[model samples]
Target: MTDLARVRAAAERLQGHVRRTPLLSSPFLDEIAGRRVLVKAECLQHTGSFKFRGAWAALTALDQGIGSRGVLAYSSGNHAQGVALAARMLGLPAVVVMPADAPRLKIDNTRALGAEVVLYDRATEDRDAIGAALAEARGLTLVPPFDHPEVIAGQGSTGLEIAEQAAERGVTAADVIVCCGGGGFASGIALALEGSGLRVRTAEPAGFDDMARSLASGQVERNAALSGSICDAIVTPQPGKLTLPILQRLAGPGLVVTDDEALRAVALAFQRLKVVAEPGGAVALAAVLFRPAEIKGDTVICTLSGGNVDAEVFQRALQRQAVND
Candidate 1:
């Protein structure tokens, strides 16, 4: 499990670097779920995702000399933009290796932040291997998306913000839900909640339910089947080695929702809450809507982790919502 002290240190380290996003109460969501619901809008964060928190924390935690050497990373989208923006802020060059199928909007945003983009086929090429080789060849520091300790520590900052915000609002023991991909964000948030009164849970897509399975089996589980979902950002086949144990220890329970449900949540966020939530970001809300009994407490906080959906995907999600209605 991630140390609470380390998580707090990361929060302190990133004090001025990231936004302390708003925690807004949603009456509609509360009525639907039969509980008080607050949305932590990290979707409004820098680069339109919570990944910036971890990226900034990891990059800033490094030695000043390392920053001078530049940084390299492999991401499907969000983390790529996070690292790119963070590196640019620190005057460091960054190379992000992304899947060819990643959303064009994310790619354009990363490039706009002055980072080099290297595209690879997810089927035929191993992105991590390619990134590692490039890092070794260029003497660039490699920033693993969810596996690195610093990255997790950085992500914990979001949890810290949520905790403080909740406390300020007099919410003492709410259930905090976050969407999980490789479990970095969930683990980090749970670490931040350690010793606090709140409980933490992870929400994931049904197609990529590795964390949910791993929690149940008491061992790490890897899914070889690669399926597409609207929540592409949280489609990791396995939990990161560093984040899995932390999540298993801290997170309350794992919840899985279908792609249709995820898209519906996204639409609900946009229509009812007037918030732009990417499909991955909306999974936690979907969990609360679809499986309310599993989550205890009158108060619940769901982190809207990103808002980087492409126009095409967003339109499709809207269409799905119309059909469902």
Candidate 2:
């Protein structure tokens, strides 16, 4: 389990840098679930994703000598932009190795943030191997997207903010739900909720439910046939080694929703809350409204993790919603 003290220190370290995103009450969700639902709008976060918290934390945690070295990382999308922007903020050079098939907009945004982009084939190339070779050649530090302790600690800052925001509003015992990919965001949030009198659960798409299957089997299981989903961000084949134990201890049974459900949730967020939630970001909200039994509290906090979807994807979600209506 991640130490709460270290997470608190990270929160302190990131005081003025990361946004303390709003905890919004959702009447629509409350009506459907018969309970109060709060959405943590991390879609408004830097880089339009909560990944910035971890990237910033990891970069800042380095020693003075280490700071002189550039940073290198492998990511599908969000983390790539996050590390790129964070490195720029800290005046550190960054090189991000991303899968060639990742969203083009994300790739363009990352490059615009002043990071060198190296694209590889996710199906045939080992991005980790390529990133490691580059790191070694350039004497740069390798920042793994979701497996490092500092990265986990940094992501924990989101949970800390949620807790504080809830307390300030005189609420307690919230069931905090977050979308799980490699389990970084969920594990970090659970770490922050350790002593806050709240429960934590993870949500994911049905076809990409690696963490759910792993939890049920009592061991990590890699999905051999990775299927494409609207929620592209949470489509990891397996959970991170460091994150699994933390989640096993802190999280309840993982909840899974369909691609259509996730897309609908994204549309609902736009229509009801006037917030644009990417499919991955809307998964938590989908769980709160669709999987009430898995959630444990009258007060709930769902992490809207990112809002980086392409315009075409967003429009498709809207069209699907319209057709259903």
Candidate 3:
């Protein structure tokens, strides 16, 4: 588990490198949900996701000479772009091993940031295996997406900001809703919110709710399938080894949202809050609106993980909403 002190230290280190994204509110959503809803707009963060904070924290923690040799990582998309951008900023070479099925914009933006890209089939190839071999051959440092202490602590910066921002708005307690993949985001925040009077919960796509089942079972569990869900970003095979313990200790029962619910949440966010939230990114808001029983506070803080959805997908969500109405 990432300690609050380590998270605070990460905040200090991320002073200039990371963006303090706004905590947005929608009276419309509040009226419907029957609570004040605060959306931490991480979609507006640099590289368009909260992943940048963790990537930078990991990079900065390594020995200085490692930067010259470079770093290698495996991500579906967000973390790859985050690491690519971080390495670019630090003047370090970056190579990302990405699944061939990752969103196109993410792959494009990562290369645009000057990192070498290695594409692999998620179902056939082991990404970690490829990344490790490449790192050894190229003499580059390895930065796993969510398992490292620094990475988890760095991701906790998101929760730290919410605590400060919510306090500024006179909200001392809120049910922090996070879109969970490998438990890093929710676990990190839960650690940061320790004793702060706020509780954290994770929202994941229906069939891919490994963390949710794991929390309920009191042990880590793997998902049955990973490719069928529309929420590509949050479909990990299982929770991380390091993140599971923290989540087990701090987070509540995992909330599960269907692909359609996430799509509806994406459309609602656009019509109500004017934010372009991807399906996986909008799952927390989906839980807030459709599964209110899981939430325990009068105020809810949601992390809009990213806004990297392709153009066609976003349009289809809006179209579905029009037909339903």
Candidate 4:
């Protein structure tokens, strides 16, 4: 149900709230990818991720009476912090259900942002059920991570920026690669670029590539494993009902990248672009850097979706760059 109009409306709502992340490029990165590469440093966005854009849009779009009662959401990490901080800013109480295995930094950050955190087992438990129960018990409106129309519209605002920024740089046509989980971000961008020359493509971690598989098979598919990948920020079980349909109609074939590739990308982004990228946030950059065969055209733009990484994980990623050097 999300379209360009709704995305533009969301951008209007987000005018003063969210940061318009910059589009960055480095000659070293360009040489590595064998093409001109532009990285959208959304890792610098509020809460250290692009999730803030959607969180703000979704929470603000809610009915005043309903939102004041509180809001609830479930996410591995990025979305949790986004919703938590947005709720705090709006003077609304928030309860976030996060997987027990989510990065410690994200869990602690959510709590520090003044939201109550609930931990759940991602494999043996259903986060949706837990969130729903909590929401019903507390009279809280649920702000979904990616499935809702408002959230998609909020995320679509990223695409609007990409299109305009690319134009300023004289990039009339290129591939826009997005790090996709439930397809909300990618689908939103696709909708925003509906008639633009920039084509949207999705990138995912290898084992948790439900979006890639779904795009390949032309049907929604689920990932077999849930808690193994380091890209927890983007490890969703399946594409959302609303997101999948939009992607199926608008997006190009999805690309899949490995954990090592993701980590390497995190390191490289830090070294080359001086931007810190968490594993999930680096997948799109990984696709552009390591999976060059799957990409096309003379130019590519990708998002560094988040920077909410644990110290140890970030150290590991950085060491890879040191080892290579």
**Whole-model alpha-carbon lDDT for candidate 4:** 0.91
State residue 269's C-alpha deviation in candidate 4, in Å.
Answer: 0.5
Worst 10 residues of 3 by lDDT: 101-110
Ranking by lDDT: 4, 3, 1, 2
Q: Which residue segments of model 3 deviate by more than 4 Å?
A: 100-104, 121-126
| Candidate of highest lDDT | 4
Residue 85 error for model 4, in Å?
A: 1.1
Candidate 3, 1-325: lDDT as tens digits: 3699988888788998899999998898888778889999898888888899999888888889876899998875788888999999999999988889877777788899989989998789987789889888989998888888989988999999999999999999778899999877888788889898778999999999999999999987999996798899888999999999998888878899999989988898899988889999999999998888768778888899998888998998999778866
The TM-scores of all predictions, comma-separated, are 0.95, 0.95, 0.95, 0.95
| 224-260 per-residue lDDT for model 1 (tens digits) | 6766777888888798999988877777778989988
All candidates: CA RMSD (Å): 1.7, 1.7, 1.6, 1.8
Index of the highest-TM-score prediction = 3
**lDDT assessment of candidate 3:** 0.88
Candidate with better lDDT, 2 vs 4: 4
How many clashes does each candidate structure show, in the order listed? 0, 0, 0, 0
Q: Which ten residues in a row have the lowest lDDT in candidate 2?
A: 1-10
